[model samples]
Target: MVTLMRKQFIIAVIVAALLAIAVTFGVKYAQQGPTLGGDFTLTYRAESFHFAEKAKPLNILYIGYAKCPDVCPMALSHTAQAIKEASEKERSKVQMIFISVDAANDTADAVATYAEQFNPAFIGLTGTKDQIDAAIKLFGASYMIEENKKSYLGYSIAHTDRLYFLDKKGRVRDMISSPRSSEEILQKIKELL
Candidate 1:
């Protein structure tokens, strides 16, 4: 009877250990966020941009246009602040890519100038209508452009304001929706790094 009880206790301990290991792994995986990716190519400052070829830097992609009056500016400001808050080592490992949704109005020079207003390090990208459409589809983002004669830019573009954080491997690891404080964004970036 004693030997049987000891064997049962050992089996129970083994099962508990296995369960703990599985739970640890599951939690870690869950923290990594959703898996989102597809072919995306664009032109940044007249240069070709391709994620697959650039293997090392963590890319934080923001989809908006230069003409955005509120959301895009705020988002870009917050992102720039977050990047500034990161340690120099951590900052060097990250890249902020702003893709213009208003391909028609946001010329390469315009996009570059707009992005540089936030941070000179920020890269601005835009493409032809078809290329922009393909990139939007790949990133699962939505945007709508409407004529606004009263506005200074002659039009308005409504687009998804969320920031897509892709890891060094070029996999979309996290999608930050809603506005987060610079500190909060920095923490999220650190975790992925």
Candidate 2:
């Protein structure tokens, strides 16, 4: 009877340990974000740009036009600040990609200039309307170009003002939205790193 009781106790303990391990894995799997799919062959500095060459760097993709009046500038500035705050090693492990939504007005040079104003490390990309539309659809982003007769720019683009954080595997780990401070954005990036 004593031996039987001891075996039963050991089985219970083993079962509890197995249960704990399962729970740990379950929670980790649940926390992982969805993968961002889509292939983009855009122009950067008049050359073709591809994400595949760069390996294992966290990619922060922001879609905005170069002439954006408010939100895009603010968000890019915040991203610059966050990059500045990260350690050299941490910064090296990240890349920021800014894609232009106003393809009609924002040329490759214009996009590069605008992005470099915020951070020289940023890679700015612009594509044809079809390519841009494909990227937008893949990311589930929305944008509309509205003609403004009174405005000097001739038109304005309304787009989703959010930052897409892609992990090493190209999975979207988190989205940092507008109204978030630089520190908040930095913290999110740090957590991913």
TM-score of each: 0.78, 0.80
Task: State each model's C-alpha RMSD to the native.
Answer: 5.5, 5.5
| Residue 157 displacement in candidate 2 (angstroms) | 0.4
lDDT tens digits, residue span 147-180, model 1: 8899897778889988888866556777788655
- Tell me the tens digit of each residue's lDDT in model 2 across 121-184: 8988998999888876667788999999877898888998989888655567778777358898
lDDT of each: 0.84, 0.84
Q: Please give the lDDT score at residue 97 for candidate 1.
A: 82
Highest TM-score model number: 2
For model 2, name the residue pairs that clash: none
> Where is model 1 more than 4 Å wrong at Cα?
1-34
